[model samples]
Target: MFPPTPPIPEELTLVVDGLTYAGLAFGPVDAPPVLALHGWQDNANSFLQLARALPDVRLVALDLSGHGQSSHRSADATYQIWDDLPQLVGVLDALGWAQCAVLGHSRGAIIATLLAATQPERVHTLITLDSMLPRPAKDEDFAKTLRAFLKDRTALLNRSPRQFASEQAFVERRARMGEPPLVSTVLADRALKPCDDGFAHRNDPRHNGASAVRMNEGQCISVLQALAMPVLNIWATPRQGLEDDIARQRALIAENVPNVTSVDIPGHHHWHMEPEPAEQIAAAIRHFLV
Candidate 1:
């Protein structure tokens, strides 16, 4: 059975480009790190339940730029998938960590895939939860995608975040986003911040903008094929087209990478936030690492 959640981890910060990146560090101080990266709009606390269940390995969950107490990017900068690589590497160098395992969810999983491919020496194993390398960019949609990206950027760049009257209102508002709605209170631990009027979410409005450039299917495969480390991919029930695409990519990884394990589990995308799935997922990771 799942145990009570552990105490909050110690707060840590890594500065890159003079901007502060916030993180939560748990487990032994000297153990090789198992870097935990949250998906878009989620914060370091997204890994709280997972970290609590994984005591054998050190886990450090980062809020990636613009999400939590971490500093927002320069106004001219965009949060492209590739843009995070160098800075993430900077985080490793700053911490004096030469090598470690990477546990990433969603957008962070894409980063982990890229990091392991590009900087194989720094990452030992790659564990992804409900996500994988990004979808390939289509040549036919380049102009359309760019137009959409600019339109969205213009609409979102100057907008201010909505202030919620109360935490309950905030939680309910988030539930309206889609199916298998995440637990609002669990999300609020990192998503909400007190404001003079009420509570405002810490997310950057610009994060809603789509990327102007994306990798093609072949390019994505090349990156995954480059990985010299073991890969563990966890999946929730398929949501249709997107999940099918990931399955195709996983097939490629299975064919190329020396070791690859894919597990299908029951839960929504935010499964790691729930006690039951988080416990199961952590047990799987604990066994994988050993």
Candidate 2:
């Protein structure tokens, strides 16, 4: 089992262009900081388990602008991978951190790569977990996937606050959906907020449908080539067809970047949520950083 959630030193907010990002800080503030970024549909709390495992390091995790406790931007808000750079910069500035390491998962990993590439001086180290360069869209399949992702967002946005006839009903449905089982209990505890109407999802679905900028192979190669920081790329084994892809990705990184290392952790993509594998990930990170 995972350790209990560590006590947060404090809850804080960083306001960027009138939008508020809710976050928590852990470990010693004086230590060289590490920013933790979660994957799509996940929040800052996603890092809690890992944070507990790496108690010696100062860590800051935030709800990206539409997830967790962060406020949703206007419907016209332009959301894209590049847009996140400034937000991250702003967070660092708010914390008075000039340089820090980054640990990102999935989408966050892509963003970290871009940031380290473009702003090499600001990012000292980067670690990507279970992430890959965005797959290039070919023909209609690209459109299909984008449409499906957007449709889910639209539905979530239009959903009315559901009042579970019973807590068991909600639990049963969530299980059926196969939502990451390991963190379901933790997620359930944090997903709801008491209201006059009983309970409502604290997460904003409008943020869910935010527009994404697709990165092609050339773009991905360019970004990796530009990275100057030491990088540790971790892949999850048993990932469908990913073993082959990871081999290619490693070659690309090794050939282009001066300092790069790779590791393949056993398990599925969401290994961080699983207790045993998460420990391995934590151990790997600790070893790499040292």
lDDT values, one for every candidate = 0.83, 0.74
RMSD value for candidate 1: 1.7
- Relative to the true structure, candidate 1 reaches a TM of 0.94
Q: How many steric clashes between backbone atoms does each model show?
A: 1, 0
**Model 1 Cα lDDT, one tens digit per residue, 181-282:** 456676676677899988998888888888877888788878878888988888877556676787776777677777788888788888888878888898
RMSD (Å) per prediction: 1.7, 3.4
Best by lDDT: 1
